[model samples]
Target: MQGINRCPPVKIFVGLLFAFALNVMVFTQIYGQEAVDSNIISYTDKLAYGVDLSTDIDEFIVSGPDTENFHLVTNNDVKLTLRLNYKFLNLSFGFSPGFLSGNDDDELKGDSSFTEYQVNMFPGRFVQNVFFRRMKGFYVENTEDFVPLWQEGTDPYLQFPDLKSIEWGGYTGFVLNEKFSLRSLLNRQEWQLTSSGSFIPALRYNFTKLANTFESGSYGKENQVDLRADLGYYYNYVVSPKVNIAPYARAGIGPKTSKYTLDGVVDKNTYFVSDYGGGLQLGYNTDQLYMGIRGSFNGYTYKDESDNTISNNLWHGLFYIGYRFETPEKLKNLF
Candidate 1:
């Protein structure tokens, strides 16, 4: 780790953005049109654009036989996102604007930043997603566990201002039932007129890097790769012609390969990991406008040698409003 950077370099981030843009163009050109069951699903064939306001809380819990459990968490923040959807391609970019008032109270929790780029494609019954995300800065969440008789309001949590994490991953899957439309629940380019459900199985893979600027650390830097098979059930209940409620749950288990660097030496380890998540979404859609809110909780856990375990848990909420309109000839031809 002598020459390695603590975070992904600027070049890699720029390359990822370019790759995401390239995929958006290729997918829109090739998979822009597809046939589906007319009764169960309705396609507008129009371009949709929108903005989303989201709030997320993420934390990591570490436990060992000899040490007490402690939590490291990022500062809670609100994020802004821009989204565009045309036919099969759905692309979004999210970032935290420094102007947001709440996150600036970093004196207690430390400062943090988050950014992500994601692309989703829906072709008939198949779904594909690719995403890259970066997060930096964290502080101890359970300060009481570390400081004796610590007052919550006055005491500052232990901060790791140099900690950073970067992850990139993708998943591909297909819908089991043709009657159920996953597109209606996700991108909102299609409308589901009837209540239906489907079983989705997908293959997911990701690479993650975790590092800190500390010169002498037990785990100087860690890189991990995970490949998992996930099975999920999604159901949409159409209460009215323009309103729907959807619920989804998923679980996955897989093997993780991790490489840890310490004092110029490297150690490799393998562990089995499990993850679970469930969420609810309520949406209202019309020919030209759409709005929705969603809430979800997700977590994954892995045990190392001798009962040492680590878990990452996240809670997220999102609200979005958007409009759809006929695709202009200029925009379609340009891509």
Candidate 2:
């Protein structure tokens, strides 16, 4: 009778021991899967290095220095960009090389000064653009130059930035869940995206400038600095394991806090800026590489010191191709 009683305790102990062992095995498997998932990206990752090519196509209009009747049309102004990124950090370098100048000749009405101003202003104008948003300004030293170039009785003069520029910055990311995350940036870049799906809210500060001389004393000196924030969101649709589509939206506002001198003239300009946009991205994802094309419509409205509102609208597009290099062939030999 004593032996039978003792057997019950021993049986209970074995049962508990088996259950604990089973739980440990299950936990180990889950941990292994999580570790693997963190290292490999679906359409995005914690670290990556890659390059991107993009451009902005702008259609701008100028109306009234005195009356609402003054109007001038500037069309198809293009700025080409090249970007390099490493994880949360990025650096972009851009130069003004105006493409599709075909109808630009007639658009300025054969006035050499207008043509000169339009051609020379592209680099600086494009460089001043922060995160695909452009500033509005006229670089004329004398107001008298508006005649013949503008409507005879009205006022007009503004051109794209013509110059060389360098942009450098960094970003940080946090995950909230499978469907949402947050990213914050302190840099000159814009639009942080993922292929699976995510909502990213961001904050930023940007400093943009124009070069006094580039390519053997070409381009001029102008600079502007600004602070801004954006609320961004996107969702992904899967077509296959390797391909997907993402559509996104963003809106933001801030202020232009600094001014610069242009051609012996101090620019007495003050600005309050607002921007919003939407776009789509198509991507192909794999273990070692990811690439995609994205297109978006971007608009910016600026209120100057005179309380005059100016709007610039653009179709911005980007092409990206990236390959991760962290897991080299030699790493597999460590085991």
Candidate 3:
């Protein structure tokens, strides 16, 4: 009787081990099938929409005596970005409208600028981007001077002319890691004022995949933040007489551009004075969609041969709203 009892226990142990091995084999097969199915599905079918708003401020200005001046500027920008993504493939489209204004004290002048920019892009597979931009503004000696430019009888020549531009470009990107992507873009831009075309070559690297953290269930807490840094070389003909090359970094909720000013002075005379500042963007995103705000900073510096510089900065902000829809994946678990 004791031997019989021991035999049943041994048999039961063997049966349990066999069942566990079979489950493991079944799980491996299911995972393999899912991977194959994922490859067969087109990523474009999964598209989502997003909106962003941003605000930014410049830390300081570097200029000459007549050319180097400082003023505070503010910008309000609204953007709608769409994403087409599946598995490892991703594409995006974006549109932004911005308003900028300058605040000035004595010895510094004020200005107002407005711009609208739109872009279409494919991020990973083969990077491509097309953009259109329009800007209009007035450079004023003072607040009183700016009002006259808007008046019909006032001095139109005193104000900066309206500028419009369109650009198209394609680039290839290689992903070095989850946090880095190297890209090079060749672009052609048309400027309305000069009626001239410009070719630009740019190489940039993305340092942080902030959006990925959100997707990975890492930022589930309230007020989660992500920071990304970028370093880039832009050789372009539109902004300056010579190729202006600068390195810039963007750290915040999302991607940003850096601001620079180009100033040229002749014999106590100032010519071609322009201000450019980086942008700030903040947004929240989920698997299905995203929403956010953006702000632009604009400022100007004017210099004379004697080394007198006048600069002013201003602020403007805008609100953005958008949505996205993506193809749903198969649900694996039902409870």
Q: Per-residue lDDT tens digits of candidate 2, residues 222-324?
A: 4656555766676666667667677888888877654655445666455777878898877776656667888989876776665556665777677777665
Q: Native-vs-model 2 lDDT? A: 0.44
Stretches off by above 4 angstroms in model 3 are 1-44, 51-117, 123-127, 141-158, 161-175, 179-283, 294-321, 326-335
Clash pairs (backbone) in predicted model 1:
none
How big is the positional error of residue 245 in model 1, measured in Å on the Cα after superposition?
A: 0.5
TM-score of each: 0.90, 0.51, 0.34
Q: Residues 15-69, candidate 1: write the lDDT tens digits.
A: 6556656765675578664566775555446888989998877889999989989
Q: Please give the range of 10 consecutive residues that has the lowest summed lDDT in model 2.
A: 116-125
Candidate whose TM-score is highest: 1
Higher-lDDT candidate of 1 and 3: 1
Candidate 2: residue 209 Cα off by (Å): 3.7
Worst 10 residues of 1 by lDDT: 1-10
What ordering of candidates by lDDT runs from best to worst? 1, 2, 3
Give a tens-digit lDDT track for model 3, residues 1-335. 01111123234334533543454356446544222122111223434443434333322233563342332222222233443333222334443343323222112322333233323233332233322222222233232433444543243323222211112222223223221111211111101111122222233222111111122233211111112222222221223321222222221122222222222221122133443444443333333443444455555454434465544454535344444454455511210
Where does candidate 2 stray beyond 4 Å? 1-55, 59-196, 210-223, 260-270, 322-335
